[model samples]
Target chain A: MGNQKLYKGSLQTIILKLLAQNDKMYGYEITQHVKELTKGELKITEGALYPALHKLEAEGLLDVEVAKVGNRLRKYYKLTENGTKETANKLAEMQEFLKTMQHLVNPKFSLE
Target chain B: MELTKEQVLQIDNYISACGIKYYDVKMEIVDHFASILELRLEEEPDLDFKKAIVEEHKKFSNNGFKKLLEIKTDSVHKRFFKSSLKHLFSFFTLPKVIITIAIFLGLQFIMNSISDTEIFFNILQGFALLLSFRLLFNVNMRNNNKISFLSLSITLRFFNVFHLFTILFQFLDNINGEGFNNIHLLAYMVLFLFYWSGEYVYYQNKKEVQEQYPNVIV
Candidate 1:
């Protein structure tokens, strides 16, 4: 479980990773998915989720599709081709950060 | 726990009252509210719908929906600028670059060959005015049809139309009675190409939106 400060920086990476797995997701689905995955440890507030989504879309890393779902229009986001490549890069970066954190926190851990 | 039609309308009213005016933004927020409300009702059957709505909305932080609107608008502007730049640069790419050069050379030749510079300028001015009016007419038609959701691309097209008009007036004022030198010819050629590129981008964007949202009466 990560704190808000840690989670804030990786929110975009987490979203890109999730969208890489899922074909498409709407706003609420994303929040609930994160909460469920973390077993209630991580709660993605709507305030954070939407702005991140919008930013990704703006950056051409995500594409938007609006569908009429049960009377209301739901905006579903999926990764673009560039986003797919970006997901791999972001995941690698996150892995490196985690390894560094482990080396710092656990003195016995070796880089090898 | 499916939401009733009345409940959906209430959610729409809530979003509208919260100042989420853009149709696209409103739709997204309404959908978010709907899902949250349904989950709330499912968890606590006795919770009142209105109360649940308020509770769910409170999760949007202290600024409520205002922050969402700002973020959405900012995102749209960024996307619009990026897409426009891409389109503008496409003229310098392979295949398109050939056509761009051809147009440039063709315009330069015509401008140099024409002895009556005023006639050529008048023709250019007329074309600019015609394009401005056509864009204004298209925007008005969309507005009258109640399709007021000006997406980023559409908004850019509107801006370009007005911008072309301003450039036309400026060109007329600045170039009047001045001999058409090589630099002036090159500038006019660039302006013409830019205007064409803008129209091409606008047409492509409009076609895309029309295809994406077939139900949108645009």
Candidate 2:
């Protein structure tokens, strides 16, 4: 697994990106999807995921829909208009940070 | 494999046993717990359900469900606060300002006409008390499986206005019973309108949640 502390700041970015693509997802699905996509290298604990989701909801960055599926109510979160805009900004910011980190860590390396 | 209604109830009981008793919080955890348990059952056909539940519960953070409940409550409180502020601000702008000014003038007129301020103070306190009772009455009118953190937090936001009154009471006591001054009237206006706007916003939020989540009470 990747160092979680390093990934901590990026959790919101990662979640925003996923919601952008998937339209909507519930709590467990987000965690499972992240783990599956990263091949178990990234694991989102319930502790981190929920607070982030609730924070986003409070900020009006996301909207929630609760549905009865099988025997339980599942809260599906979708990006608001502001959340979509924020996702783009966050993605750009993450890309810029990645580029800067790469240049600083390996000055001699060139992707070109 | 889908959980039977019995299994779902058992899971709800298990989460409640873990001390996360709020209905909304329990609903999320119960569903997540059952999902993981069912996945485990699929992977290992002979897996013990009770043992699997314990293992899955361990997978939650060290603080477990209590931590989730805390953060969720905090978020709900923040949202209600933000909404209250928004409502209060709206009265300061556009068409609503007219109504706000009228209410302030009406209160000012009453304070000016009264010879003794004590009666005015008592009437104001009675009005505040009435608002509190009305809020409680509205909540009691709703039927719920159990109170969710959202409902509790929203209801509490209305009561928080009373805390401001407490502060004023303490301030007045410190000053040794000074009669109602102009400043006091202005403070009462702000508090009264704030309480009114906050009640409007917070109660509306509770109503929306009740509509959205059938199991959650106002």
Candidate 3:
């Protein structure tokens, strides 16, 4: 929440990275996983999460499987082949972005 | 703690009452509500089901859900159009490509040979109407399940895709040629391709939706 604006751009990358690690994830599970990973630093609101998931799915980067869980049907999303390739590409892009940001915004520059 | 069928139905009714009618959309929300309600009910033994659902629904406000539907419609249609074109291009392979080209040339020949081009336009409009009716029927049959998928709802457009052809009528009228020119030929080819692509899309989309959501509503 504190750095939500900063994290917003990386939401899709975050999702792909997560799906790449975990074979598949549903809506709530992705949110909870991020919370657990970030130790609550980032909370994925349902409002922001579903649209991202659906968009990725539409772009053919994700595939969905609906399963009956207990009394309700759960929609699970897994990365497609395109999604896997895209994950690698996005992560590489993110890495380069972070390096650039570190140099510009948080450089370990000390006055010599 | 798991929710009872009655509890799940309560969530379904609550979501349906909230204007989220599509099963594909509601399934995720209902599951979210169920998962959270189960955890909440377990955490508090005396919490009311209505109260538990309300708590979860507040997290995803009605406006948020509306925003979700808007994004969903835009994205799904993009996917729908893309998938249709993908399927259309799939015909460009062996054996089938032969048939495709043959049928295409055959139609071109017919267009060139026919003295009255009116029949071709009539067939085009009729075919377009037929597609609308077939896709409309698909939408209805899907709705018969009490909860339809959102993609099916996108097919509810009555007209306008082929309305451009009407303006072409005036273009056709001004021409003093015996047969269609390359311009007119190109238009007919595009319309035929749209007609074929739409048919294949309608067929494939129905299968995909049926596969996506089974009869059980949650």
Q: Which of the two candidates, 1 or 3, achieves a greater DockQ against the reference? A: 1
- Can you list the residue pairs that collide in candidate 2? none
lDDT of 2 at B132: 55
Candidate 3 C-alpha lDDT tens digits along B84-178 = 66766764568755766687787778877888776775675466556556544654555676556677556434123544554455466447444
Task: Sort candidate 2 into its docking category.
Answer: medium
**TM-score, model 3 to reference:** 0.75
Expressed as tens digits, the lDDT of each residue in B34-143 for candidate 1 is: 98888878998887888778878887777897777788888887866676677667646687778877877786778778898767766766666776676667655455
Q: Write the per-residue lDDT of candidate 1 for residues A1-112, one digit (tens) a residue.
A: 6687779899999999999999999989999899999998898888888988988988989998888787667789999999999999999998999888889999698566
Model 1: residues >4 Å from true position, as ranges? A109-112, B43-51, B88-120, B153-158, B161-192
Q: Assess the local accuracy of residue A35 in candidate 3 as a C-alpha lDDT between 0 and 100.
A: 97
What value of lDDT does candidate 2 attain over all alpha carbons?
0.77
lDDT of each: 0.77, 0.77, 0.77
